[model samples]
Target: MKKIALCAAALIAAIPAASFAQEADSTEATAPDGTRAFGIEPYIGIMGGYDSYDKRSEFGSPRGGKMNGALIQGVAGVNVPIGPAFVGVEGNVAKGFGDIDWEYGVKGRVGARAGESGMIYASGGYEWVNGKRAYSDQKDWIYGVGVEVGPKDIGLGGVTGNSGVRLRFEVDTYDFDSIRPMAGAVVHF
Candidate 1:
């Protein structure tokens, strides 16, 4: 668990350096409207939802077990605008409560701008689950949809999209069997 957390931190720290590795192309610096086109985003959010084991007991009980609780997560990713659309890759670590202990995953998103400072996207990823049950093959593929409503660029003045605080909401399913919904704020760099 510590190793996974440390790796996530290291990956976040490395993105800035990766961005600097290449010489800045004029196009990479700003969008058509002259706002910053690319940057690193670090987000923290409250994750709440239910986890159920595939097999159920006779009384419809969790064959193995189930967890109903909220967890916290920290995610870091990079975003770049391509015309009216944006692309991003993110990695996250989560600590669960109740019957769940931990989860980690990486995801990719491709979406278009929603109005001026907002975005709507669809994402898919692979996640690993650590539950109280002694189960094998806890890793599975997940898919979900989400949206971000950022603070109006109008209020930020100066650069249109250099930075802003965004409200994010999303829901994902592990192996099409269990669901996890999350919401919170994201800080753009």
Candidate 2:
């Protein structure tokens, strides 16, 4: 409960900062093609990260430790572009390391885009943690912030031949205690 409260507080505190970012990017919030980002972006990608577990009150058994590995997850979401701001809801499923065999969640995100090249956003969601231990599966909330930068945004336009392709990096906390950091490639179209 403490972790959830902290995450909620942090997200609430970030609202003003997100507003400032949107205001700054309002003058130029288009993609490279001079159009706002839109549509249902369904993407499949692989994510590798370190998963840390809570030491205290993490269940009565202290057998399973932290896991460091990768998980392949599929994400599908729709983005509503409102001038320089964007809002979206996404759902994902992943299989990974440690006592965590698999997990799934749905998240909502809001952010500001700097042209079509990149975006910075904050997200929170409800997740089900599928642990390897019997009776270890649990439900909880997760929150995090992330940034996406595309090839077009970084002066790699002609070479990458990529539209809506972006690099994703984020650090998310689950069960209000476990932290998982992930990075992957995705396309918005």
Q: List the global CA lDDT of all models.
A: 0.63, 0.69
Q: How badly does each model clash, as a count of residue pairs?
A: 0, 0
Per-residue lDDT of candidate 1, residues 93-141 (tens digit): 8877765688889987766566667777767678877765444336767
lDDT of 1: 0.63
- lDDT tens digits, residue span 13-44, model 2: 46645654665645555444456544444555
Q: Give candidate 2's error at residue 73 in angstroms.
A: 2.2
Cα lDDT for residue 19, candidate 2: 58
Deviation from native of the Cα of residue 157 in model 1, angstroms: 8.6
Superposed by TM-score, candidate 2 places the C-alpha of residue 26 at a distance from the truth, in angstroms, of 11
Per-candidate TM-score against the hidden true structure: 0.66, 0.76
> Highest TM-score, which number?
2
